[model samples]
Target chain A: MAEPVHEIEVEIKNVEGLHMRPAMQFVDLAGKFDSDIHVSNEEQSVDAKSIMQMTMLAATCGTKLRIKAEGADAAEAISALQELVEVKMFDETPGK
Target chain B: MEIKKGIAVSPGVAIARAMVIDSKDYRIPRRSILSSERTKEIGRVREAFDNAVAELTELEKDVAAGESQIKDIFAVHIRYLHDASFGKRITDFIENELVTAEYAVSTILREIASHFAGIDDEYISERAADIYDIERRLLTQLLGDVRRGVEHLTEEVVIVAHDLTPTQTAGFNKTFVRGFATEAGGRTSHTAIVARSLGIPAVVALEDVTASITSDSLVIIDGNRGVVIIDPDDDKMAEYEKFSRELTEFEVSLGSLRDKPAVTRDGEEIQLLGNIEFPDEAIMTKDKGGVGIGLYRTEFLYLYGGSEPTEQDHYEAYTEVAHHFEGQPVVIRTMDLGGDKLPYAGRQAPETNPVLGLRSIRYCLQHLSMFKTQLRAILRASVLGDIRVMFPLISNLQELRQAKMILRDVMEDLDEYAVPYNPNIKVGIMVETPSAALTASLLAADCDFFSIGTNDLIQYTLAVDRANEHVVTLYSAADPAIFVLMRSVIHDANKARIDLSVCGEVASEPEYIMLLLGMGVRTLSLAPPMIPEIKQIVRSVTIKECNHLARKVATMDSQRQIKNYLRDAATRILPEAF
Candidate 1:
């Protein structure tokens, strides 16, 4: 059975924005899921599982990105990515 | 079989096996593969990616858990290595383009690195280093031990590269990596600074060091002369061995002069101070027999620290030098940043002639708040020790007056906050421009002292750009015109009864020292490394002899004749040096 695709929009919160380390963390977390995940800025969408594509976003602080996941675990992927980008800010120190 | 000459950024001699490295993208010649060999090339690509990921993974565990910052750096490397899209790009290039795995990897990585380097965003552009680092790892795996470096090395080596990033230079294992040489770099490049701090010998700006040298061959890096000799003949090797030994002995002999005073044979006392670019060299200056810091350039602080440094940053750097000189006078030059060195925000339309444009005092005047911040910090640290302030490239009286007026304003600000400072802080201006030299008497009346910056004075007086190879021969500190300017400034300083010092390249040079002393310069401000040798010169010569040599050269019309006379006089005094 085809599963519903879950999607959410979030803003980068870290002062340094989505740099290499943060992009790597996001891609790593995305790799752990069974869902096929994709991320998009206003311009274009890319595979969230690929760090090379993710870092090309060059998303700065306050740049909005839409994350979508499709699979049985699509809801969990969306929630985890939202929390990482919005809540955890990829665990980057605040105001550095 | 070849000797390459470049600019030496550090001092030492190193002989070891050569490990040549190429940057992520530049100058990799294209190599092709047959269609029948495509499968093997693709297999090699997969193996290289797997091997690179394993290497980084092993390194990640070696890093301690508490050092998450370093771990994160490795994590990014590993993620790039494991990135399926990146691997596919390489393998697909190998299959479709019929190229060797190494060539495919090089071309693909080069394209990506150049793309990142071209990006306008600083954060994204800096990732070019990461791409380069990953390319190095994968290429080293595919090409084998010839390109291997740092953590993979089992024997001592001298790194030969087309170019090296500061990160790559800093990551070198001090014990196994004896030294390094590169085809491209400069004296002030971050890589050079790291090499200096690591105390490793490095030569840079070579024509092509990586292309000439064979892998694991015996190589010699003479950083003292900025020469790299590759696969020397036995006789040449033997000569260098003796030369290296003599140098070590020579340095030890110099150390013995540390306690001796820089007094001429006839009892003429001269102060040999040091010109330092960074605060860390303060101790070296004092240790090498510098009486004080004659010129502590603040340009590094201005350009470094990624944005304009805060007041605390200024204070901290100043105090670090002040702490080294307890009660000894340190002549701190105000920010002498060039027009081209300004931040993106403060910059204007590009000037066609930056050297003669808004720089030094002009830059300070336009950016008043930044200027005041530095002045306040310098004044705040003035109370710490005998800290004196000097302005640079002051071509006219108006600039000098304006700079002094700003200093007074900052002092008043400190007074309101009850922060104590040296109220009688001595102010001086660099006598670099010909205009300043000619009007020394006028400026000496308002300023506390004068320091002759011969480097620029020669340039401005002769109207020659030293960076131009064709006309640089015309630029000479010993030109009769330069002596005329020096004599005038010295005459003015003596007439006003103010302190005078020569804090320029001429001061450090042995050939010019006698002329400087004969021209009535009482203090010589030079690099710390040259202090002990200069002290030896001071101890060996009599002022009467210097005056006589000066007199003889003054009568000579030709600069070539003056240069020869000076060299003969200096060499006769110090036979071993020449």
Candidate 2:
């Protein structure tokens, strides 16, 4: 039997794109799910739970990323992680 | 006069033109060095890094407690501050290129900053600013002059630096520099402590003081009141001039009391002494009508020079002070280093509650070799003058016995080597904790004399941390409970026939002088500048009057009541002195 897999694509809304702090927040959200999540940009794909790995992707503003999850909570994880990229306004409050 | 308030670090008054020296403007002269000098260069780099980390860590704690927004910024900065990669890279460059560590650090920081700036991401680009701030701070440390921008000034001026390190304060030219004002520092900072020792007026933690006050602006620093006046008008200047004249007159009057005995109206003689730190300060003891050096803080031997002081270093320092005082009793306090004192490199573990943790005599007992070295040095220097060895923060008689045992061992070593010392040198303990005060009778039997350090005794009894801003309101030297403890200690010491003295700042005030005299304390040790006024009060008031006031004050419940009563009594007794 093939494990269930769900995927979604969302644009980086924050002006800073995947900066250190925002990337850390994204990794923290992904870590709360029971599913294995991976985020991929145009050049590379990395585990969403690792700040360094996600930073390596360098998903800037207006850039698109494919978020994939595989597990029993694949659908919930994909939707949650996608919501952070699509709707969560990490950029609403400016950084120093 | 435009007055600015800051935390008072040292006491005095100074009128001088401002000399603003932003340490950020400091630039290192870039040059290559020989391999033979690499070792020293490496040591410099390590020290600079260590100091930066310690400084930033302290700032981080402050920021985290309040401003949450900037706390994150410091978080990121501190993370990189301790990054192994950053340190390793700098050390590797210094060793491999054989260049000065200053040059290497500058080059590496610039390269890293440029790399971050070159990134397309704005978040990464802004990190370049953090790198720059770090670079400047590290460079400032490497300059070896915490006074980076004005290390070699020619004229007299009030130094206005962002902050001063112990090193910068040490390098101050007393002849040229009138005083100092800093934008960031605390009352307990190493710079402040040094300033107090040097008797230089200083005001610290005046936010943006360096930025607001320009160089060449006429200024007056009243460190006693913690006020700084920049660019005073004619009216204000006239008023200050009159004030200054009166001050000089008052100082002359105090000098007149130098040769007078501190005898009460009833013919009760009191032993007045000065508490000192550096060896040069011993002269002030005699000038201030002090008959002896009551408290010679020895922590500076370990603190001033980042490295641990050698046995010979301790010997020379003790011998110098002993010579300066002639035959006056010089009380050299052993290393009170662990808590809020010397932050010796690689020795103390980071303490959570330092005041309650390993400190003073306890720390000395743990580190026996360093303790023995100091004891041996003090014993050796005893022959030069009337010297006394005082152990600080002794909690119980067992600790005293343990300390005395170690002293005995060190004395035996000196005897074996045929070293000369005063065999009957008086031994004492600083009764700084309530536990020691409660059991003073027991401890009094073991020691020759007792010096009540009311500062810590009050703090411990009240369960208050004096330095903690949030709980500082609860710390009071005049609290009724403190009086009870002090009375008990005084009674016990008197019963044991052991001489006792009050050496804390509480003893320096005229109000406390009367109260302490009433409590049967006959010896007083305080800061040199305070001795004159206190002595003047002692000379006028009778022991009978003081005892009456003390009996009344003991019944007061609140600190406010006790303070008000003492204030009125002091004024009534010393109308001329006031």
Candidate 3:
């Protein structure tokens, strides 16, 4: 069977970028589904699971990113990742 | 054999073994490599840098999600990583200058880290810790090495450090870390604040404290007095143990009053309320038997972030407090920012004397948008329970009128929008300045109530900088001027037939409770822990006795006389009660 693919665009509204911890959480959630996920800013593409790659994309607090998910659970993975990226999750960690 | 002393911020005594966690120093390991291997090392270092940046990006996202205050730290880290020096200088030194990859990276990291560390500013120096932590992590990954050393935290150990960053304090494993002592920092420092919040005994700003004691040496730390006793004798240890037990018993006894009403023994009822800065503090207020929240400091909500909080955000916070108190009253103070409490909005420039600067209601009125958002939220939340709105630093009827006008305007707008709200919300002014106290009677007729903020009142009255160490000794709440102001404000509120309260540090001091009660203060709001003690003091004294003392205090010419009278009164009453 051909792998499924899904895409979603989200505008980052938080003042700080999708820095380390949030990316890790997004990756952890993505791992739960059998999906090949990739995230991209306007300039660069990065493997969603690779925290290093995601960070190098340097998505600022207000930067928008296009999330692409492919594989058996691509639809569910896209929905979960979109929600994770959209929600503010790093507000409590001091020195974030 | 030498002793150094600083201001004692928190109270507690503890004896423990000393454990020192120095900020870890990172040095690249020696590796024999040809030109090809050097190239691979550079690639590996690049990967490590990328990984570190990724970790920071994720941290930023988590921080943003939680709406945390320390987002700037991550922003600084991102800047450091992307700096021209990080890649350009190091790469040039390694490839062009023919230096070893490890040597180039180490030299660059040390140079940059030291530059940040050497800065005199505390905020700047704190950034150095972050740089160092990131650098160490990156170097370890590049070298394929692991830190073998593990500093095992023991139950009896007292943590000694140059200073603790907020991250260090938050990451502390409370199970084994019994207490903490620092060589630098004060009561308001993140270290001290975190230690107090975690219920750990800590003494800060003990100069050269790290050099004085070693790991496993028995030491006594008196957090209340800011004293550290090294290698104490058995007699001293035994004495401390006894004192600790007494303290534990005292805390337990106070805790037992959590559910009890704050009514005096003679049936004179007084409202004992909590002054809170966060929603989480509502739990603390309830746990400590606070009848309600007397002052919810709204400035904290506006301070951390750059933009103003949306009406919904303010509404949620106010509603949460109101719901927490249920049927009880929760007085939410409008944004009291200025001077020491600077907010992102309405701060045009630094003032020579911020105490007398344009602040509080004056600043809020100038920035109408910010002010109205807060007012609308407070009014909306008032429908949930007993919610009262307060304006801080009101000096005259004109400022009070202007503020009330803005509040009225916002309510009208909300009405036109058909927004749900309580139109009859009680509005009050904080009698913080001397001008406000002198004119309290006139202002009382215009407002529903008054809460005296003694912190600012004492400072403004005495003309002393409470934050300045050199002049802090003169910043006394017991000063005759402060007492006079308090008397004037309370008397004015009483004459006007409006509710009166003293919501300040003065309300928490056991010795001052009777004096304030005597001064015709029907309500006392303070930190939650202080409520029970003050309540206990109120229960021991009668309204008649308090009124008599009030008369005497009113006639007293000097603070010294008032202090002597109160001390004598406490001595006479405390023994009988015990």
Candidate 4:
């Protein structure tokens, strides 16, 4: 069977970058899906499932990133990741 | 026998031995190695350092899960540990120059920590805690050094220290330690928070505490009175024991009244509200029967993290607190950050006289963007529950008018943007400065309510720096001037048909509560724990008696005279409680 493909662009809105904790959370959520997911800024692209890679990108709070997913669950992965980043799931993390 | 006193941050009484935990006791041992083995030793140290860093990193992650505010401190520590100096110079010194591992690490750590400490910024200086934490971790990994060795409490002990850090106090074994007294720290210090959390009594900033008291000597710690009694006689010891028991019973009795209404004996309803600095305090208020939050100090959100919280941050915080009250009013005083509360929201310069310097509403109006952001956030959150906005340190009608003008602009902007908010939200002014109190009649006409902040009002009126020990003696909340100002403000507020409340440390005192009730302060807001006790006092007193006392106090010429009169009346009427 062929893997499905999904892509989306999201603008960063938080005052701080897609820093470690939030990136780690994003990776954690992406890992739940069977799809292969990746995020790309203007200069570079990295696997969305790797927290270290995501952090190294140094995405500022207001920097836009393009999310791409490819697999049987590609559309779901893209939709879920988009919603998390768009709504700033990390900022609303419990007890944070 | 000797006795010392300091500010009572947390209240309780305890009898215990002495346990002195010095920060220096946690130092690491120096490792020595031959030139031939230098490379191997450095390798081992590096590996150990890495492991220690990893452990701290993990621990930090866990702590961050609970408190995100401390994450920056942890991050700075990580950066310092990974700095080229730590790995390069220390490694080179130990490998080539042949310094002992302990000596080299200590030298580097001490130098770096001292450098950071000398930066003159409190936030950067606070990083010393991070360095200290890292050093402890490294020492434990290399030499199996454990500073906090035991957790068992065989006998009662009074912990003495220069200052207790949050981690140190949190790691303390409660059973053995009866109480703690520190030589340095204020009422709002982290050590006080830990003490309160552990249900132990503590006295802070009692200078010479370490020099005066001997270890294992019988001592009494009256945290409520901020007194430390050393080598008390049999009579005094017995009295303290009785007092301790009675206090425990009193606290338990007060706890039972947590759900009761704060009504006078003659059925006069008084609104009991909480003064909160953080959203977490709202839970405490609810637990203590607070009908609402009177003074939600927004300064703490800015002060604690050394950065301005974004509008969303303020909105979420305000929304959570408002929703917690479930329709009960939460009067949030906007960004009272300045003066002594400097180095907050990007103001770092020191002032000669912080009390009279740029602060509160005056500073807010000058910084329109920051001020408007907070106002917008508060207005946006007002729709969640009963939310009222208040301006702090409001002195004159002009300041009041200027503040309301900015608020109008914010509301208009929000309206233009189709933002959801309570359009007719109630506005109020903090009757803190003497000018504000004097012009309360005019100010009250402009605002929806009046909340007298007696802490600053007294400080400003009497020219006393409450934080300065030299002048604190002159700071009196019971001053005749304070009463006159408070009475005039309340009267003006009443005449304007606006709600009047007093939210200050003075309102927590049961004796003062009666006088305020008599002065027509229908709304009383204070710390959560004081609510029940003050409510009990209010329930026991009649309005007529309170009015009589207020009238009598109004005739007093000085603070001392008013205080004496109040003490006498309290002793006569509520002798048992007093």
How many residue pairs clash in all the candidates, one count each? 0, 0, 25, 4
Docking class of 3: incorrect
The weakest ten consecutive residues by lDDT in model 1 chain B span B165-174
TM-score of each: 0.65, 0.69, 0.61, 0.61
Candidate scoring better on lDDT of 2 and 3: 2
Which candidate comes out best when scored by lDDT?
1
**lDDT, candidate 4, B424-540, per-residue tens:** 899998898988888888888799998988877887888876655455667787887788888888889899999989987778765687798889988888877667777778777
lDDT of 3 by residue, B344-407 (tens): 4454666886657777887798878878888888888888988999999998899999998998
Write the candidate numbers in order of decreasing DockQ. Answer: 1, 2, 3, 4
| Candidate 2 colliding pairs | none
Give per-residue lDDT, candidate 4, residue B434.
Answer: 89
How much RMSD separates candidate 3 from the native structure? 16.4
Interface RMSD, all candidates in order, equals 1.4, 4.0, 10.0, 9.2
Per-candidate DockQ values are: 0.41, 0.10, 0.02, 0.02
Docking quality tier of model 4: incorrect
lDDT string for model 2 (B25-48, tens) is: 543334455677788878888888
Alpha-carbon shift of residue B424 in model 2 (angstroms): 2.4
* TM-score of candidate 2 chain B vs. the reference: 0.77
Return the lDDT, model 2, position A54. Answer: 63
Residue-level lDDT tens digits of model 1 in B1-578: 78889877666788898876655456654555568878877887888888888888899999998999889998898888788898898888878877667668888887888877887767778888888888888887875533334646778899887776533543455568877788766553444544553456788877767767643367899878999999899997998899889978987998999988899999999999888767777888888888889999887676544588889999999999999888888999988866577554465788898879888888899889989999999999999988999999999999999999999999999999999999999999999999999999999999888999877788789998754435656878778998877988999999999999998777866888888888888898987877877788888888887888788877888778899888988898887666
TM-score of chain A of each: 0.94, 0.89, 0.85, 0.89
Report the lDDT tens digits of candidate 2 across residue range A1-96.
Answer: 777899998888777777656765687788788888888877777878765456546666778899999988899998887877777745444223
